[model samples]
Every structure is written in C-alpha cells, then in structure tokens.
Target chain A: MAALVIAEHNNQTLNEQTAKTVTAAALVSTPVHVLVAGENCKAVAEAAAKIAGVEKVLLADNALYARMLAENMETLILSVAEKYDAILAPASTSGKNYLPRVAAKLDVPQISEILKVVSADTFERPIYAGNAIQTVQSPAGKKIITVRTTGFKAAAEGGSAVIENLAATADAGLSKFDSEALSKSERPELTSAKIVISGGRGLGSAENFKLIDKIADRLHAAVGASRAAVDAGYVPNDYQVGQTGKIVAPNLYLAVGISGAIQHLAGMKDSKVIAAINKDEESPIFQVADFGLAADLFQALPELDQELAKRGY
Target chain B: MGSDNSMKVLVPVKRVVDFNVKVRVKSDQSGIDLANVKMSMNPFDEIAVEEAVRLKEKGKVKEIVAISIGPAQAAETIRTALAMGADRGILVKTDGEVEPLVVAKILKAICEAEKPDLVFTGKQAIDDDSNQTGQMLAALLGWGQGTFAHSLELTDASAKVAREIDGGLQTVELKLPAVVTTDLRLNEPRYASLPNIMKAKKKPLEEKTPADYGVDATPRLKVLKVSEPPKRGPGIKVKSVSELLDKLKEAGAI
Candidate 1:
C-alpha cells in the first residue's frame, strides 16, 4: 500500500513543505503519490512530479478545490482514498484544518505533527509543546499523519514522475470563503528560511524594531518576534514564534532582546546555530544559544550593522 | 425570529496541567508527572467558553452548555466554566487520555441529543496539541467548521468567522449548526467572579460515561515510549559585538 501526500501550494508555486512531507511519506512506503488539488495548478503539479520521492502526481484541477476548504477537500480525498494506506500532509495551518476531517470521516485516528517515522506503524511526535516526545504505534488499517516540516529534509528534485489528471471534485456547500488579509513581507518566510532574526519585548517599542529589521535586511533573513513582543503590539500576530505560534528551525537563528520563556523556546530550540544578544546575561535564552553576547542591543545594533557592512554583507 | 426560537451553544473544555507550570516527564517514562501538578481548564477551551457566554449575554444564544471528557476531577473544570457563564455542564466520566477521534464521536452523540446550533472548543488542547476534535466533530455531524477563529459574528442561520492562519488572517462564512475552534485573539477570557463561583456550585450538572454514548474509549495509538527532548549544551559568552560576530562566522552562521 502506497502513501498519498497532499501537496501544499497556492496554484502558482509549490510550497517547500510538500517536498519535505514527501520525504517523510517515502520513509513509510514507496511509490509515493502526491495529490495536487487546486484550480489551474498544472505548474504546481509539474513541480511535485519533479520531487525525488514522488512516484505519481494526481492533479485535481477544479474551481471547487481552489480554496482547499476542509469540507470539500475531505470529500475529494475520500474519493481516491482506497488506493492509499496512509494519507499525509505537512502540518501547516491549512493542512491542520482539513486532514482531521478526512480522518474522522474515515473513522481513523490522526497522528499530528509527527517528527520521525520509526516504522510503517510507529512514529514519534512532540507533546506538551515539544517538552516531551511520545512514540506512538498506529493500529493496523489506515494511517493519517501530518508531518512537521522541520523534522525531515526536503526531497530533492531530479526525477520526472508522470502526472495523472484526476476528475474528482467536490463541494459540500457548508462554508464559503469570504476574504483574506495576509501580511505582505519582502523577506523570506520564517518557517523555511535559512537564517532568522527575532525581536523580543526588550527591543522596547514597535518603532525600535528597526534595529532588528536592518540586520535582517542585510542578512536576507526572515523576521520573527517573541510572543511578548507581539503581545505588546510591536508586531502583528503572525510575526510571533513560540508555542501556539509558528515553529522555525533555521540554520542560523539570532535572538534580539528576547527573554527566553519556555513557550518561546519550544518553537526555535531546533535551530542549528542559535545566538542571543541581551543586556541581562542570565537570561534563559542564553541557555540554548550556542553563542551569547551580554550587551545593550541599542548600542550593539549600530556596531553590528557597521561590521556587517564592512564585511560586505 | 419567532418567540420560540432559542439559539443554543455547546462548548467543550478539557482539564490539563496549568499553562504556568513546567511539565516534567515521569521517572518511569509512562507519561507526564502529574501527582501534585496544578490542573485547570485548558486555556484555549476557556476562550471557547467565554465566546459562548458572550453570545448568550448579547441575547444571541438562549443556553450555553459546557462539557468535559476526563476523570472525576474534570468536574471541577466544568464548575469553572459555569462560573465563567456556561448555563450548565455534562461530564463524560472517562479515565485516561481519550484520543481526538473518540472525543469527537462522543461529542457527536451529545450533539444529537442536545441539538445545539453551534459547537465551540479550544483550537487544541495544550497536553496533546492535537487540533483535531472540532473538525472531526464537524465532519461527523456533516456540518461546516471554522478553526482557529479569532473573531466571530453570529446571525440567525450563519456565522462569520475570522481565522488566524500561518501567514495572516482569513475569514469564512459557515451555515448554521457549525463548529468553531477559538484562537488566542478571539477575546480575553474573564476571571470567574467569587459570586459566580458560588452560583456555579448550585447550577445543574449531569454526569455520564463513554459507554452511554456507545463509543469505545480505547486508544488506537499505543505509546511506545515517552522521553525528554535532547537539551542544548551550555554556551560561551562573547565580550563584544565584534567578538560575537567572529564566533558566529567561525561557526558558519553569518
């Protein structure tokens, strides 16, 4: 029995999470099939077909799936559910919305945010906001899983898998999309970025965030904020990175003015290299940081900016 | 709207380790150490109960029922909800961790009997962090769902919900008899007043079992192990900004 990976995309460019999810799916079973369901998402399907682990791309291009509503996506996935023993998706906000519905309709339990696939029937996932890891064994039958994108490397792109057109489309007429107000940013997305610079309440005010922004612009890194900073209205809610917020695992994560709360640590503890700059040397963030600098960010920012500029960054 | 029209809302709450307390894995590796841990209503579920209460306060809803599925101690969580303004509560007495699917199925049976127009829950429980029950319940009832809702407005037959997504916010309109899971920005939950706490003790409370709903309470996923995540090693302090940059560059982090 093959695994079915539901691709994450915006009908234009395929999301990097899909490739990572395909890698996790391949760990469970071979002949990995990716279901690209959206309106006019041929390019996205083509991109999925090029992922290394995908064996087939099933494209369901229709108006009904354009928004990927949970009710409609559940109906569509069930139409092709027979051939798959496992259904997987990246645990994005969108995937978290729809996959549980599919699982419920199938009368199966879902394994959320799986970090590792130990075997076909067993897996490891974080619980209590990554404070503890629980290894779970799924009952024999069907497995529904959501992959934590940071856990697995993105599958490489070199193969040419065939894309098969899927004719199934569904509309439950239960909900209607109204409008969206997405934050527009020129920087890289926080979850998938190579480097990230996050500000905390110690930065003082929304206007003072420029200190973090200038460095982020120089390094071409995504900007994130501690929940305290976001709660203080220094940034929008989406900029928050912590428990109950976005989880990021970048190669280089720089914390500025952030007091590391346990909730905050839950999100970024997986970073490869962590650096923190704070006046309080005893801050908990220093515990997890590979490198720490006890200095006032107000004075340090200008010097760091000057140094980076001198180095031609 | 006729005089007989009375909108009803059902909110489900879970009792878990309080948000402020640091959770620790048990020495035996069975589960979290909860011997003396302070237990409270899951924070997200508290928001859900508050949302329902606000609806009833505005005369948009006639009744608000809070429900919980856990041990006998979970009844106290329901009392806390009642103090926050739920009209009544139903406690499904179950012993251990009930997976989201089973919880949803039990809620489905409760919905059939209660016939509430709206079901509200915390987006996810802090313990398991499985954001699945509301969507699963919505699926089992063949109704629409709005998850991670930060803002919601109700009409006689529809609900307009503003949800928080990864990149930003998205709004969706769901028809009547729907499920809504709340996010942090929905509304600040009110502290249970001392007077209300006394009144909640007098409020009607009903108890049942999972067997009453005819849903098996067995867990499908077996826990092979429980362990602490690897800890980050101690770090070195750099004296100057230039020194910090040099060390970062040495580690290929620049």
Candidate 2:
C-alpha cells in the first residue's frame, strides 16, 4: 500500500508545506497519494497532483470540510485509512490536531514532529526541548507520522496524478469554532520566511517592538517574539517562539534584546545562521549565534537599518 | 449503565522547575542540573489534572487516578494532583531521565491493568519537551488520542476535544477509551488549599518498578557532554537614544 499524505491548503491554493510533506512521504512508501480535503478545492487538488512522486490526489469536497474541522476530517480520513500503510501530515497545527485522532482510531502510535525517518517503522525526534534525540520503533500494525516540513525539501513540481473524488463522511457534531482573528501582515509568515527577526523581553514594552519591526521591514523579514515577550504582553501569543510555541528553521535568524532560553533555542536552533544583539554578554543566545553584537538594541536598530538601506535591500 | 461500569480516568503528572525561573547555563557547558533548581508541577500536566478533577466534580467521571514516572521525589508531583481531587496515586520510581518510549511502554502496561475509559497527559514535558509518551501509549494500547487539547467535553460514548492548531483551532470528536494531551491554555489550574494538601498525604500512593511491566528504562540517545552555551560579548551602551539609533545603523540591526 502507498503512503497517504494530507495536503495543507485552502480551496484556492496549496501550501508549500504540502510539497515538503510529499517529500517526506516518499521516503517510506511508493506511489504517494495526497488527500486534499476542502470545499470546492479542485484547483488546489489539481495543483497537488503536479507534485512529483504523487500517484493520486484524493479530493473530498464538502461544506463540513471547508474549515478542515477535525470532526468531519477524522471521518473522511478514517474511511480511507484501510487502503494505505501509513498516513502522514506536516507537523503544523492542523496535522498535530487531527493526526493523533487518526492514530487513536487506527490503534497505532502517532509519531509527532519527526525530524528524521530512519525507516518505514522507525524514526528520530527531539525530546526534552531538543535536549535529547529519541529514535523509536512503532509497535503497531500501521505507521502514523507527522513530518516537520523544514527537515525536507519541497518536492519538485510537474507530475500527473489521478484526481478522484471521495465521499465525505457524516459530520460528528462536536465543538463549535467560535471565530478566528488572524494577524494581517504583508511580511512573510514566521514559519516560511527565509529571514526572521525576533525580539525578547528586553524590548521593555509593546511600544518598543516597533524597533524590531523597523529592522524586520527593512530586511523583508518576519517578526517573532520570545515567550518572555509574549508573557510580558509585548506581543500576541501567536508570536511566541519556543518549545511550547512555533518552531522555525529559517535561513537567517536574528535575536534582539533576547536572553536565549533553552526553550527558545529549541524552536530556532536549526536556523542556518544565527545573530544575537543584547546588552548582556551573559545571555545564552550568544552561544549559538554565528554573529554576536553586544550593543543596546535601541542604538543598534537604526544602525542596522542604515546599513541595509546602503546595501539597497 | 450501572455505576460499577463507569470507566477509570488515568492522569500522569510531572515535577518541573517553575517556568519563570531564570535559568542560567552552567559555566562548564554541562546540561542544566536541577539539584538546587526550584521545581513545580509541569504546567501542562497541571491542566490535565484540573480537567480530570473537573470531570469528577461534574459527575461525568467516577474515579481519577494520578500517576508519575520519576524518582521518589516525583511523589510530590503526585501529591499535588491528589490534592487537586484525584482518587489515588501511583509512583513508578526511577532515577535520572527516562526515555519517552520506555515510559510509554510502562504506562501502557499500567493502563492495560487499570482498563481506563480515558487517559490524560500534558502535551509535552516542560523539562525535555518530548511530546511522545501519550501518543506512544495510545498506539501501544490501540486507543484513540487527541493532542494539544485546549478544551474538552464528554458524551455518552465519545469525547469532543478542541485542539490548538497553527493559525487557528480544530475540534475532534472521538469515541471513549481515548487519550487527550493538554496545552497551556487548557485552563488555569487551581492552587491546592491547606486542608487538601494535608488530605493528599493520606491518599493511596502505590510504588512500582518499570521491571514490573517488563520494559527496560534504558535510553537510546547518549549525551557525549553537557556544557553551558557560549557567552555574549560586553554591551556597548550608546550615550542617547539617537546615539543608540546610530549604533544600530552601524551594526545593521535596524
């Protein structure tokens, strides 16, 4: 049986992570099948079919699936589970939310946020806030896994796959989604951005966050916050970067006024290049930093901006 | 259904240093040791215990049994849960770090004996941040699971769990005999009162060994060394905010 990957996309467009998920799926099984669940998501499904290594695109279109609610999704995915040996999803919020339920229903262990696929049944993942690496073998009949998209390259585009419609299952009337207030920003998302500039509690107040924002805007980078910043009310909870928060692996990560806590490092330690700017040389962030600048961020922000502008970025 | 047929609820708790503790990397670069570290109940696990207690309070749950897999010191964590209204406690004594898979295997054996209707665990342990044991145990038992849950409700035969997802939230409904992992926003756990703490001392706490479950508590990953992270250079404070701005420009931080 082929590996089945759940596509992360709205009806209109597919997410980049879906392709990375396909890449991860290819490691375990042959002829990957991508499942796209959304309302009127034919365009998205068609796009998904073009990803290399995918043999089929299973489309389940229904109003109940418009929001990808776990109730309806679990039913739809479980209906098709018998035909696949493994079910994979990117370790995003959506995957983390529903994959475990699927694992439960299948009576299999769900490997969450795997960093490496050692084999079809064995995997390596970070434990204890990335302090320890664990390699585990699933003792169940089927393998259920969530892949961290950053660990693999997105599959190249342009391959034809069969797109078949799958019937939606009966809706499980569970919790009602009250509403969502998504942050609107022109900057790239923190997870997908190539460059990220984050601020820590040292920024003092929410008002001082603009300093980090200016630098981020100048570099066309996403703005992130440490848990300290979020706890201090300097930013929303979504901006928090740590073990309990968002994990990002970007090309360049710059930390300003942040004392890098171990929890915070667990989220971004995989970044390609790290830069730290803080008044305290004793801050832990400097240890991992490729470039360390010991200066008050208040004085460093304008200098960074001026330099970037001079370089025509 | 008769009261005798009610399902058991098993909750596992852990002791961690306070999240607010300003941890400093030791100069030797070895791993952070908690010998003198101020410890508290793992925040997410506290939420798990709270949810279990609430279910019992509402009469939806019959009995709440709390367990902790750690050194004898972990008894303190179990006592905290008992004070929160758990019916009994189990301490699986071990020293040092226990591999998540080994822990999961042992828990699965315990759950098999208890035959719980539901299981609750923190989404991840704060100290190691490994979010594996709950899912692994669910798999080992062939039960359903809902992870990173922020809200949950019970029905006649299934559970409705609200889980925190990236960019939004997703809700899953699963049949009973499920595992649910708690996140921070699940609830603000209540503090144990004096009487409750005293009462917890008398609550049943059974001690067991990992060997009882036929699982080896050996670690798969070995630490070659533990060292403090590197240090930052001295800070150069600018004379004024404008001067600071100028320095930022020079450093390209802006």
Candidate 3:
C-alpha cells in the first residue's frame, strides 16, 4: 500500500520540511503520495508533484482548508484515508495540530516526532528531551507518524507525478479563525537557517541581547534564544529553541551565553557543528559542543563581530 | 457571564520525572531509570490547572475537576491540582505505559459522564512528548481543539485562544465544550500554599480503571529498545576569541 504525506506550506510557498517528510514517508512504504490541502494552493501542489519520491499529488483546494484547521484537515484526510496504509506529516506546528485528530478518528496510534524509519513497522524517536532514543514497532494496520524533518535528507525535486483533484470535506463548524500576529523578520527563519546564533540568560537584560543580534546579523544567521532568555523576556516566545520551543538542526549552531540544559540541547544537538561561548567552564553545553570557548560574552561578542568585519564577512 | 451559568472545567495533569532531575537510561536499554527519581506535576499541566483556577476566580467558571490516567501515585498530581483550586479529582489508575490514544479514549468516556464545558490539558508531557492526547480526545468528542494556547479568553458561547505557533501567535475562536491544550507563557503556575495543601486533602478523589470506562488500554506500539543518544566527542577549550575564530575557520564552520 502507498503512503500519504501531508504537505506543509503557506498558501503561496511549499515548506522544505514537506520534502523532508516525503523522504521519511517513502522509507515507510513505496509510491508515496503527497496531499496538498489549502485554499488557492495549486502552485504548492505542483511543487509537491516534483519531489523525487512522490508518485502522485492529491490537491484539495477550498476555503475550509485555508489555515489547515484541525477539524477540517482531519475530515479531509479521513475522506481519502482508505487508499493509503500509512499517513505521515512533518512535525511542524500545523502538522502537530491536525495529524492526531486523523489518527484518533482512524483508531490508530500516532507516533510523534520520529527520527528514524527502521522498517515498515518499526521507527526510532527521542524521548526525555532527547536523552534517550526509543525504537518502537507499530501494530499491523494503518500507520500514523509525524516525522522530525532534521533527521532525514530532503527528497530532491526532479520527478513529475500526476496531480489528482480531491473533493473538500464538509466543515465541522467547530472553530473559527480570527487573526494572527506572525513575527516578521528580515533574518532567515531559525529552523531552516544554515547558521544560527542563540542567546541565554547570561546575556543579562534584553538590551544586552543586541550583542547576540549583531553577531547573528553579521553572520547572516537566524537568531535563537534559550528558554531562560525567553522566559526572562530578553526575546519573544518565537525565538526560543528548546524542547517546548522550536527544534533546529542547522549546519553551524553557536550558542552564546547559553548554559545548555538537557531540554535546550534536545532542540539543537543534531547540528553539524556545535559551538558555545559561556563564562562558566563547567556548563553541560560543553559536553555536546564540538568547540567551546570559556569567555565572557559581553567582551567576546564585540571582538568576534569586529574580527568578522575584518574578514569582510 | 451570569452567576447561574454552569461553566464547569476539566483539567488533566500527569506525574512526570521532575524537570530539574537529569534522566538516565537504564543499563539494559529497557527505559529511563525511575527507581529513585523525584516526580512532580508536568509543568504544562500545572499551567492548565492554573488557567482553570483563574477562570473560576473570575466567575467565568463555576467548578473545576482535575483528572489523571496513571498509577495511584498520580493522585498526588491531582491533589496538587485540587490545591490549585480544582473542585474535585478523578484517577484513571493504570500501572502500565498507557499511550496517548488510550488516554484520549479514557478521557472521552470521562467527558461523556462529567460533561465539562471546557477540557484543558498540557500540550505534551515532558516524559513521552507524544503531544497527541488532547487532539485525539477532541476528535473522539467531535469538538474543536486549540493546541499550544498561550492566551485564552472565554465567553458564554465560545473561546478566543491566542496560540503559540512556529513563527508567532495565531488566535482562533472555538465553540464551547471544546478541548484546549496549555502551553508555556499561558500563565505562571503558583506554588501551593500550606493551608491550601492541607485543604486539598479533604477534596473528593474517585479512583477508577480503564476497564470502568470500557476502554482497552492495551499497548498498540511495541518498544524495541531504549538507549542513550549518541554522544559528541570531547571538545578542546579555546582561551581567546581569536583562537576561537581560527578554530571555527579550520573546522569549516565560519
């Protein structure tokens, strides 16, 4: 049986995580089909059809699915659930919101944030804030899973798959959309950036967080914050990177003034190059960091920014 | 908003390994070592209890019932909720590892019997972090779900919840009798006072089992192994910022 992967996207652009999820879906079963459910999202559907491993694209364009609300998305997924044996989605905020509803309605257990596709029925996931890796086997039936995008390589765009139009499911009328205050930043998004620089409570006041910001801007990287830094109001909740916050696996992750708690390390330990600058030499972050610099961030940040400038960065 | 309105709320809490304690994997790769670890109410569930209590304080709610689906010790977690101002408690006692789907099924049965106007649960427990129960419960009940809510405003007919999304906040309005999952920044949970803790002991706590609800709490997923994650290699400490930059350059990280 084929696997169905729900595509993650805004109405305009396809999120790269959808491509990564397609990779995981293919590993679960062959002939993966991508489902794009949104309003006026034909371009996103077209993009999903080009993903290498996808065999088909299921497009359900309607006003009810514009925001991909849980009630509406669950109804839509279940309408076509009979054709697939495995259902998969990226563990994004939207995916987390709706996938379980489909899983419960289908009477199956949903695995959240799997890191590896061990087999058709077995998978690996992190628990206890990524302190442990657990391998689990799903029962024989429909498999429901949310893929952690950082754990898999993205399926390259080359193949041309057929697009099939799916009818919209009836709206549950259980919820209504009001408004959104999305953070508008000129910098790259934290989860998708190749380079990320994060600050912690050791940065002191919110004003001092500018030091981390300047370095991030110079490096053309996204800005992140530890849970303490966010809870201390040094940054907004969106900037937080931890177990409860965003999980990022960038190429280079430089944590400044951040004493890595296990929860904080859970979000970024998968980065290719891990570095830290903390005054405390015995911080737990150093255990996972490939490069550790024990220096006061206030003095070191400015010097580092200047040195980068000297190098024409 | 009237005084006679039956605005009852239900909050579900879980007992988890304390957040401050570092969790260690067992030597046999069976699971986490829980032999001597201190356990506390899951932090996000504490936030849910606090939110429900705040609603009751504002006269928007009349009664609060806290529930847990775990061992008898989970009643201690419910006691913490009662001390935080919940009116009663229910313990769905099970000694095994009950996954989110089974917990949702059990909660669905309780909702049918209790008929709460609102159901609040933590977004995810820190132990398993499956993040599926609330949404699954909502599905079984055919109710709206506001997941990851940081701010919530309730009315007679609906609730306006500002959720913490990936990039920022998104507000949605869900009809009454809906399920809402609490996230961080919803509100700061208050410490239980000595008097309140003493008062909570007398609160009604009814114990039941998954069998009582006619829900099979059997394990659907089999655990193959539980092992420690791969450890990074030991790193050298750089004495100066210049050396740090040089090392990063050599590592092709700059």
- Interface Cα RMSD per model, in Å? 0.8, 6.2, 0.8
Q: What is the CAPRI rating of model 2's predicted complex? A: incorrect
Candidate 2 lDDT, tens digit per residue, B1-254?
12433757999888777776655544554456566888888889999999888888888889899999998988999999999999899999888878667778888899989988889999877766656677667755656667788688787787778776665355667677878889777777999999999999999999999998897787644433343323334445334444544554565554
TM-score of predicted chain A against the true chain A, for each candidate: 0.98, 0.97, 0.98
Off by over 4 Å in 2: A138-141, B1-10, B14-41, B50-65, B68-75, B84-87, B90-120, B126-163, B168-180, B186-196, B206-254
lDDT of 3 at B161: 94
Among all windows of ten consecutive residues in candidate 1 chain B, which has the lowest summed lDDT?
B1-10
For model 2 the interface RMSD, in Å, equals: 6.2
Q: In candidate 1, residue B137 scores what lDDT?
A: 99
Model 3 Cα displacement at A290 (Å)?
1.3
True contacts kept of each: 0.88, 0.13, 0.90
TM agreement with the true structure for every prediction: 0.98, 0.77, 0.98
Docking class of 3: high
Between the candidate structures 2 and 3, which one is better when assessed by lDDT? Answer: 3
lDDT of each: 0.93, 0.79, 0.93
Clash counts per candidate, in order, are 0, 26, 0
What does candidate 2's lDDT look like per residue over A97-118, in tens digits? 5676577566555677878778
User: Candidate 3 — what's its lDDT?
Assistant: 0.93
